[model samples]
Target chain A: MNLGGRHAVSTLNDIIEIPIDAEGDIVRARGTGRDICRTLGFAEINQVKVATAISELARNIHQYAGKGRITLKVLGAPRPGIEIVANDEGPGISDTKLVLSGTYRSRTGMGKGLLGARRLMDYFELVSAPGKGTHVTLRKFVR
Target chain B: MAAIANFEPAATRLARFAALRRALSQAESVDAIAEHTLAFVQTALGVRSAALYASTREDEDFALIASAGDADLPPSLDRTSPFIVELGASKGDLSKTRELGSMWGVDRAIPAWQGDNLVGVLFVTGELELEIVDELQFELERALTVSIVAMLREEELAVLAIQERELVGLLREVQERDALMRADLEKARDFQRQMLGAVPRVAGAEVAVTFEPLELVGGDLYAVAALDGLLRVFVADATGHGVRACLTTMFIKSEYEIVRSSAAAPSSLLAQLNDAIAKKYQSAEMLFSAVCADIDLATGATRLAFAGHPPACVVRAGAAAMIGGGGPLMGLRPRMRFELVELHLDTDDGLYLFTDGFVEARATSGEQFGDDRARDAIEAAHRAHADVGAALKSASEAFVGGAKASDDATVVSVRRVSPEEQAPPSLAPASAR
Candidate 1:
């Protein structure tokens, strides 16, 4: 499993809309994430990777981003995986490269959550503009 | 001088009587006895034919046993013979000309007696000899008495032997079937036990689970996995109880294994599961309710999804709150999507997941233990810092108070742990984490 976040492709087989509301709402998103991974035939270890990555991604939305919508869709053809996209209009990260590189840490919380999520997936991407908010796209393959 | 001259004839008559007695004693059954009696009567009386009538039981009417000259005797002596009337009035013996004899001329009706009881009657009916003296008739009656008694005894023993054989055969068949059923149940129970194994190791959470089935095989199932730093737990309960329910659990377990790889995406996983089950068991009434949750230990972020299952409870600082999402029950429909709820867990916070069997468990008075009771148990466990599994068990057991549980009960407690409580960073395996 690769945790690198990347940009989303236009291919889709199935799509799901999950709203991240209260702190507890992240649980449902992660559950749906695991269900998709399991259906894709990910091993037990890979399933955990997918679920943990989803939890971290969704948690980022709920915590730093206030509340956001997590859009899950299936990718087919070139690669088969469940693509997880968490976008928020919360205060955007000022240093996207530094945060992704794991060198930057926010005073309020450990900076490892996003980095940890990146390490858990096959592909990861982060798009953010200061004041505009942050959008993250993650993909993990069944193979 | 005249007495001595008749002595030779008397000895010859005595010899004949001995031969008749020997033949009657050696007869094996009623039919054999009948044949022997007819032959002896015919030879000694110098008659062309003789018939014997017998009663197998005292309450039954007499029927013809054997005939030498004719097979025309009526099935029952009472129907055509006045001999029964004459014999009934006199138990000793009777010889009379027939008032109304059928074709055979009536000669004598002599009672076949064993002690004072009459077992049968011998009828001598033919045209030839009217010359039988009183002494000759007395001898004939005594021989008839011995033969008739032997015949009845043999018939009774034969019937009893046949009845006993049939009864033993029936009992053996029942016992064999019972043994086969017992073996089959034991094998199924063993297979179910093997399907449930060790709990998954999650990074930042401590998971404790308790499962109790009402029967050797039950419908309760649970799965725990810590993959890529995320903790996922699932618990499900199929409908009904006992062996049928137990079999249904296997389907749930296998389907979950395939879909659990979806990891954090429980909605699609459940939808796929529903499709699989609906297709496989189209005609069956079997279905399951489930709750699936994924937790990110690092951030204490958790997402929960349910399919016709009870909501999970999150307990923090001794306070319990309900969290649930709704959807159609799994296996009921294809391509169904479930609602998802997201939650964050703080240190020392725990999520309590269970099947309805836990809340719906009944007390001796038939009162259900309900959701409130379950919350109370979790809260008590949180306050006491006790094992949640034990606390839930104790509370339900107390309420039940010796009443048997009507359904299988399962509980899964996933508690977020402090940094110190977690495994050392290096010791935390990198692959699964």
Candidate 2:
């Protein structure tokens, strides 16, 4: 997607390159998601849910990753959907199940946030290793 | 099998049933509902104790809203306690049980619901081998649900009331701020208007003044003061616009008026005004550029004092000359001295005093309509017309065409009149010319 002169591509074939430290990156990501969902003829409730999910994931990457990038593209698969891939080079997840179970301990008590995010989006995947890095991919279908 | 028949009074059971129904329906608040329902359950089902616990969505914390029967049980149980009951639990769910140490009792936890949404739980306990009254349990749950909904409704109302009060407070603050700003603006506009002196008609000179402020208040000022056989004309432009700039100009005007009365020389007036402004407005960092000229009406000679102000043009015999030497802006130094230059006026000569606003206006491309352009326009207007007012107005409009003015533009033109023009027509003989 091309957003305000900045390009963001989901895959190597359809890649969008945006400045790593661009201003209002979070707002731009969410706005682009909303605009794409609307243009793709998605329902209002589904659009809102997808936008909120993208915002939360993007914020997490920006805050924890120190510096990272995001890519978005329209996935032409079994269903018409939008896929968002956020990756960062930082201290990766130690336990994947605990993070997904919403039981991981933190200052905010790990309160059901991951579970809520899972519930909000249709397909959610998180791949992280302690030493390597973290990658999150989320997809929301129009149907 | 041998049959045994026993007779019991129908009135007793009827009276008990009527009392239970009355208690269930009369429950109003959450506590009242819980208390009445617990009492009914204890009486009808012969239970030892009953309690009601509510779960809040914000933190999933449970609080004991009502209790009945034995005081032996702990005053409260945490919302997370399995014995206290939770959503998706039934009476026969053994997996959700707590070890009760050889105490045989019928303990049932009923989930409280409001329109298919589970909101809380109700717990009832009875002695060992006690048969629970199914009809009584059903009635208790229904009554408790109604009461809890009422209490939640009241809570919602209270929250709405608080929000309404907060909104009203914010609205009042905005209104007060708006009113204060309006009054300040009115005051600023009044001060700007007072700073501008009325158009003066010299007995022997032709004069015209034009002042256009970009906003409700501006920083441009022009004053004409005639005292002690001297005609003092001044034009000042302060930095910026609106209330603060207008205030700076007002202070300058007041200080100049005060100094003009005591000082006969233009340089003395500038020095005194500069000292007063520098002392009074030092903290605000405000400064002004001004051109003050003292014209001797008797001798038709004017002494000019410039304080970083734009040069004034003197036009005589189809030639124009820039009058006065420039000095530092006022308010920079406490004891700054200014030099005065004198120019002799010829008949029909015009002195045009102005501010940078006339020359520094920007075109659409952000290019400045520089001083040279302004001078050309002035000369063109003069050649096209002889009226000084018309000429200046034409030149300003042509130079600032279709562009937003950046500051206030002011123009004051003074034309010297010949001696014969000043003399009364009846006293001058027709052959005198």
Candidate 3:
């Protein structure tokens, strides 16, 4: 849970690691993410859902933050869940609480993308500071 | 017995009390009253010196009000000092005294109170019997209690009055600036309306345009330029709403006009326009989506070029198909290439072009009136023999019901009028398809 730097955040079991710097990278991340979801035995519908969630996060990085990293992880053994962690070193969000509650939207970015990603995932956690950075974690069960 | 003899007389004491009350009541302000109180105490008690110190607004420290000759007042009087503590606890008592060297020295401290609130301390230094000192304390306490309370009240009101005047001035300034901005926006809106151009009534085509800009002003533009017996249509919408976006549309209209003579083909025209925008506004953060199409009047042949805009619906022969466009948004990069899609338009076929606001418009349930719905609307409008712009608008309004539009909506419908409708069958030119 406490992944300090960019390298430590992604586990060795990460299915795919994408460096999103342009709009095309989002499309690439979405395609590769659905494949990983399919390999984890997620149903077709769930794979599309997981892929769509990855697309929004990746696109947000390309649009507002300019560049960031997205790591797709599939956990095993005791439990199985697809996790996506997006880290950005751009201008960080100051009010994570308001953003999560769906009350505030950034001037440049639409209010729907983050909330839409949260809706697709079974678990959502966000850690951010004004000038430091933003780290988002999303997970969906393999049902 | 010695203290009793120092007292002036019962009548004189009564007269002095009444005079003190009269002088305080007539005082105009806090500082004026403090000045009067200090002067009265020195002359009535015949003291060598006197001073008055009171708490400031924050009650953190006491500020000296008025002082006369060798008063020996402290530079700062903290509210937490023991002298202030005793004054607050006992309410009004002059029994307390601190030893500082004095000239005519029976130095006494008196507390001034207003309805149980301790306002300040009064200090007097003089040579007097205990009885005269007690009498003087009673008179000074009575005088200052009335004056200090009135002084604090008047001082508070004075500060508030000054702040109110300043606030009113600031509000007026803001209102004036807002009026000027609104006037500028109105003028800009009028200029943009002129750029939409009159409804085109060419010999072989029927063109109708619908434009609705949000009060905040969004960039939605349509230009119909005729060249070499061909009609060139250009439509563009900029990102975000407001004055900045509206200005971009002006630039697009002017650039389209300037390049008309140099660029003959649809693709070349779009490419030239993109280069002009990208070069001039490289740092403006203004991006736009546009589509350019030239329709030959004689052959009904059309060539379309696009720049990151929505697909245009080609409705012909009772079926509808969307022509997809692929290119980067204009103003983002220099030398961007737009691919030209060539299509043969049959007589009476309609080409519907619109901004994303039409499809992205949300219904009451938060569902977007999507591309499929737009395609369906266009097909229905083509069948109904009604205005395509009106049909699409009514359909979207019905879909959204009463929901407010989040962005400005625009539509341009160009239907190649059949040759039979223009004139008598024999009079129709051989060049008409």
Each candidate's interface RMSD (Å, one decimal) is 46.6, 13.4, 24.9
- Indicate the TM-score of model 2: 0.48
DockQ of each: 0.00, 0.01, 0.01
Better of 1 and 3 by lDDT: 3
> How are the candidates ranked when ordered by DockQ, highest leading?
2, 3, 1
- Least accurate stretch of 10 residues (summed lDDT) in model 2 chain B? B1-10
DockQ-based class of model 2: incorrect
Q: For residues B1-433, write the lDDT of model 2, one tens digit per residue.
A: 1221111222344256677767777765545566777766667556677777654232334557677866344444555565544444445433232233112242655555445444555566764121233444455556656655553454344334434544696799999999999888877676566557466555656556767677778888888867755778888888887677887787778787788778777788889989998887776457888888877777788888889888888877656766664798888877999888888877766678887776677777777776666666565545454654455545656666787777877777777776567644343211100
Indicate the worst ten consecutive residues by lDDT in candidate 1 chain B. B424-433
lDDT of 1 at B413: 84
TM-score of each: 0.50, 0.48, 0.53
Model 2: which residue pairs collide?
A: A8-A16, A9-A15, A9-A16
Residues A62-111, model 1: lDDT tens digits: 88888998888877778788888988999988876445533344675433
Name the lDDT value of residue B371 in candidate 2.
Answer: 60
Task: Please report how far candidate 2 places residue B219 from its true position, in Å.
Answer: 3.9
TM-score of structure candidate 3: 0.53
